[model samples]
Every structure is written in C-alpha cells, then in structure tokens.
Target: MAASKIPGWVTAELFEDLLKANVEGFSKVKSFKADSGSAAGENYATIMLRVNIEVELQGKSRGRSSRIKSDFPPLDGKSKPVSYMVKLPHQLEMFQEMMKRTNIFDIERTMYNQVVPEIEAIYEEVGVDITFGARSYDLKNAKTDYVALEDLGVKGFKNANRLEGFDQAHTERVLQKLAQWHAASAVRVTTKGSYTDILLDGLYKEENRPMMTEMMKGIGSNFVKSCPTYEGYEVFIDKVKALQPVLIDKMFDFAKVDPMEFNVLNHGDSWSNNIMFQYDAFGKIKEVYLVDYQLPKYGTVAQDLLYFLISSTKLEDKLSKFDYYIKVYHENLVEHLKILKYSKPIPSLRDIHLALFKYGFFGYTVATGVMAAVLLDPTDTASFENFVGDTEAGLAFQMQLFNSPRFRKHIQVIMPWLLNRGALDM
Candidate 1:
C-alpha cells in the first residue's frame, strides 16, 4: 500500500493477522481486539490484541494478550496526515546509514538481548514486571522488514502539558533508569570481547563527515530563520557556519571512542518522547520503559543522563534539582553495577559531572530546538507563522523557542559548560 492509501480499519486487520501469525507459532488463529486511538498521524491506528497460545514455559501453560502498532497510510484522495506538512529531504537512507555508523543500533540490540534481561530478572525478583513482553515474528515473503511485538497496552505518555506536579519525581526515576541501562552495557563491553569489535567497526568514518556537516547546517539555518526571536539573521547564519565543523568533528571523535575503553553505552537519543512510563493504580509513577533504539551507541554514560534531564525537564527548573537528580542516577548506576558483579565499580560521580561539560550542549540544543516545538500548546500553532516568514507552523514553533525562558536558560548553561571544557575554543 502506498503511504497515502491505507485506512485505519485495514491497518487494524493487518496488525491482527500479523500478531496472530507470530504469537500463535503455527497454532490455530485466535481472537483479538483493536484499541481505539490513532498515534502520530491520522493514518495510523494503535491496537491491542489478546490471544490464546499453547506454549511450554517452566512446565506451565498460560494465555496472554498482547498489543501491537498498526500504522496505515492515508486514504487515497483524502487529506494527508499532519506529517506531510514538512517536506523531508529524499536523502533519508543516506542519513540513516550515517546514523548507523555511530553504532547505536548494535549497542541497543546487545543491551536488549543481554543487559535488560538481567535487570528484568531483578524486577521479577522484586515481583514487578517493569519490562514489556518480547517480540516474535516469522519471515514474511522472505523479507525481515516487518515484525510483530506483543503489545504492552500503552498508547503514549500523557500530553506534555498535562504532565505537572510529578516533574521532579519523574525526572529522578528516568535518571535512575538510564543509569541501569548504561551500567549494564558498561559491564557487557568490559566482560565480553564480541561487542567491543562491533563498537569499533561501527565508528564514524571520513566519508560521513561532509554529509554530517550538511545536515547540521541545513537544520540550523532552517531553524534560525524560521523563528523571530534572534535578531541579525546574517550573524546567526555565520554562527551556524562556524559551529558546523566543530560540532561535526566532535560527534565523529566521540563516535570513534571504543566502547570497551570508555565503559559506557549511550542512548543516542534519551529524550522524553523516546521513553514510556508505566503508572500504578493511583496514577503514581511505577516504572519507565526505554524505547526507540534508533540512536543507541557507545559513549560516556553521562551523555545519556544529561540528555534525558535536559530534554525532559524544563530548563528553568533544572538548575534547582540538577544536583539531586545526578546523585540519584549515580546511586542507581552503582547499585546495578554491583548486582551485575562488574569488576569495576561505578565511576566517580565527580568525574561524570565534570565530563558533562564536554557534551552537555547537545542536550540543551536538542531540547530547546526540538522538544520545545512539541511541548508548546497546539492552539498556539497559528501565531508561529508570525515568527518566521515562509515557514511551516512546526518549524516556526521550533524557532520561537529561542525566545522562551527555558531556551534562554539552556543557552546560559551550555555556554559556560562549553567554555569550561574548552569546546568553545575548538
């Protein structure tokens, strides 16, 4: 089906069939249900399916229900989804390849297969299934392009506007969660020789440098001009040009570091949108599930921790609680490392905090530039047009973030951090 012709109902059927085929494991097909909610775009529908399966696990049989995502294209001749508003460059494959060279995917799979299981075992020992169900699939037409995951009944996290009062607690929990993942990967790289090779092999190479430079330039130019907050368009353009090589060089340098040597596994993208939270009966925070492995790679553990904090929390509130949250993350890292029986204890908290100066701006820039757009009130979409001439509402919204207090504070923090690390001089 073309990306513009699939309907919600048809998508539901496709998911049901895919789920039944994979979960049944060649047994007779059973019944399932489709949840009512369209996620990301009008063309897609998220569904939940409950199935009866006969399988031997520890000498027992159990029937379980699963959830899966059913993404559909827009109906032919109908209005397209909101995603069509912004035109993406046709060079997506090249970009994906460049991203893969960072070794995030390999790191993610390693963590998913080896590290997370041990953490889940601990959760199970504590009598809580903080993790989601495993994904199962069969070859469909000799291509492994599509696979089915047992749904975890989660739609998405509550809207950002609705997330109030629990910000501090939620931030703390997320930090600890990131620490567990990072510490596990650290142990794996140190103990196993296999992942070390994958990490080294996936390092960014010279061929990707020009493309990386172009991508950053395009994004920065488009973003700066799209909003009205910053004065002197020419000056901003010059700044972007000057910073392009520096940022790209640093990213490549960071990517070249061996995972075993660094003893850290970075969640390349640790923003709030990539994390899913599970709540208790009273709507209290219970656990967090990290998702979207597209940018998992090996880097300083501080990178992920800082990224999550800077992306998820409001910048205005960050400074006040920053020390506490860092402590929580370090404590969790130490605990998980001990449980995994790693020979090396968690790195000194001081060293991690100091290292934040090196790459902290990444979090600030991404959060201010990207998250601000999504977090703004949707009703304010029309006003954004006034910010940037000839730009779409989404891009305009991102540009307007430069004037927000959160964005200002982010710049303030990042400037000093960069200077302290001598990144600014570079």
Candidate 2:
C-alpha cells in the first residue's frame, strides 16, 4: 500500500496512536492502505493492515482488528479491501459518554446489536445474506472515535433526492419491510421492560420541545401565507397553536401503551433517504437495506409507518395507493409477529391505520417545511434565500406545497378517511 497524502486534518501520530491503543500485535506491518473514495470525510479513512497475531482484546478475543471492517465491496469498482474508519474522540473534542446518551448513537448500537442479528437470522433461514454489513470496535481507551465495519458496496440513498417512476410493487415491498422492522421493535419492548424504558425516556425528552415548537411555528405560518383560498388555513393555524402544548404533553404518552402487546421495535427514522433500494439487473428494488439509526427509539408503530410514507413518498403517489399500502403493512406486521412467537395477536391493521390518521399530519407538516428550504430547485436557490429573508415570503414558500394540487388531493383522500374513523378531532 502506498503512503498517500494525508489530509491536514489527520496527523500521522494520531493514526499510529489509535492503532496501538486498540490492537495488541504491532511486531510486523505487512500492508496498509488509506481510503481515497470521495465519500471519505475529513477525519476518517478506511485502513487495511496485515499484522502478526498477538493476544487479542477481551471483548474481541475472536481475532478482530482494532477498527471496523466490512465485507461489502467499494463503490468505485476497485478491489475489495479490509477497511477501518478512525475517529479521534478526545482530539476532536467530542464527549464519548454524551454521544452514547444521544438518541442517534444509542439507536445505532441497538440496530447493530439487536435488529441486524435478528434480520440476519431471518435471511440465513431463507438462504440469503440480506444484511447490509456490520461494525467491529473496542471502546477501551481508544485514541479516536472511528468505527470500522463491513462495507455494503453501494452509495447511500441520500445521493438521490427524488426517485422517479417508483411502482406500486416496489412501494408495497418497502412498506412490508418497514412493517417487519416495527413489529420486531414492538416485540422487544414487550419482552424487555428495561430496554423499553430507556427507549421511551429518550424518545420524549423535554429538550426536544423547543426545536419542535420552532419548526411547527415556521411551518404553520408558511401554510397560511401559501394558500389564501385554503378553506382551513385559519383553522389549521389555530389547531397548530392549540396542539403545541398537547404535542409536548403527549410526546411520551405512547410509552404508557402496554408494551406486552402494543410495542414493536421501530426504525425510528424510516424515511426513504435512510433506506437503500438494492437493485437487480433490471434496476428495481430487489431488496432494501435500512440505514441511519440516528433516531431509533420505542414508539407507536404508526409513528414510523406514517412518517416514512409522508416524508419519503410524494403525497400524490401515496394517496393513490393509500388503502393498499396500509393493508400490506398491517398484513406483514401480523405475519412477522406470529412467526416471532408473540403470544398475543398483533392489532388489526385498521387500528393502526386509524392511528395513522391521528399522527400522519404531523409528518406532512414537518416535511413540507423542511422540503421548502432544502428541496428547492438548484436554480431557484437565490429565490429561496430571498424568500426566507422575508417573514411573509418564507411563509408563502412553506405553504406553497400545502396549496399545490399534490397536497390538496392528499388531504381530500386522508381527511375523509380520518372523518369516517372519528380521528379528525385529534
């Protein structure tokens, strides 16, 4: 391996120090390679090394490296290399303990340890390796906060902003997988009381209130200004204001639901961006790999299901298949729960579907506000910036989506469904 130019951000001493801190044998260094991929960030690199065997760390006695490695291939069609990502936690001024406490890292570890294994077992039973990859590391006195894991051999879904021509079958498959994911988490809560407690504590923390409130205010204001003809604009605004207190109060109420029957493990953030659509030769989603465990926490199954549909799919497309999509998700959830040996039958899909009406609007409201700022046409960046500068202009841009044909049709479809189910009050 060549000694490529190390970024100014990474020092040679830091690399050597981390290697020594995590692994034991350094008697012979056969080969070393630094990752040169564009996806490689400032502080981390994928390093491969061949070293003489020595005494292994306590937890990693199975002969693992000090860093993470992946079985997945590189995206650039290069040779598959043993890789490890290095992060200098102390030098980077990041608190490892505090990071551990955050919902992001906690959910990540949960997925890595709990969810992945279960999914792997299922895949193995079915005679396939549908798992994305895994990370291996030792936390004791590490010089950096880097993690090394098996690469998945593909770019992240974030690289694509909007997916075109997504068919109903693909949509159903994704929803079904999400159903399985939520079912697993719900079962975990039922069987593991302590795990559920930790998850709920993090999910409804008061610290999140201020940010949520700010976002709601910005979005509500945008909705009103965007559609002067919108019949419910004023009512929506009033409802939003009234709901702020409730939103804060009810953030943790879902935790009170009986975990024995109601809880399922959920991919806290199941948006399309967090899922990779592994394609076959025909370029369709042959399988999906869930990613980004940053927001994983215990909550109602509806929370994850509704959030993914509203945030990831176009409002119009979702409305078209709303009934079918909901049915598929519920059917899959029930099937997985029974297979996993849950004593109680899973709730009716209709119950979950009704619950979505109560919570579905939440994701739409937030997504519209965020997409306004982040998803504007690149050429219209200046217009967006200018619009954002004016309080009224910003509000108009934010509400534009709500007033669009795409959104109105969605509301028409969903509002009736909610009204019929008596969930309109919520």
Most TM-score-accurate candidate: 1
Clashing pairs in 1: 67-151, 104-296
When summed lDDT is taken over every stretch of 10 residues in candidate 2, the lowest stretch is 38-47
* TM, every model: 0.65, 0.64
Clashes of each: 2, 20
Candidate 2, 193-259: lDDT as tens digits: 4453445545456555554454355555555445445444443444444544465444445434454
Question: Tens-digit lDDT track for model 1 on 125-244?
Answer: 545455632333332332212223333342333323212212877777777777777766676656664344444333355765776575455445655554344333333344444665
Cα misplacement distance, residue 359 of candidate 1 (Å):
3.3
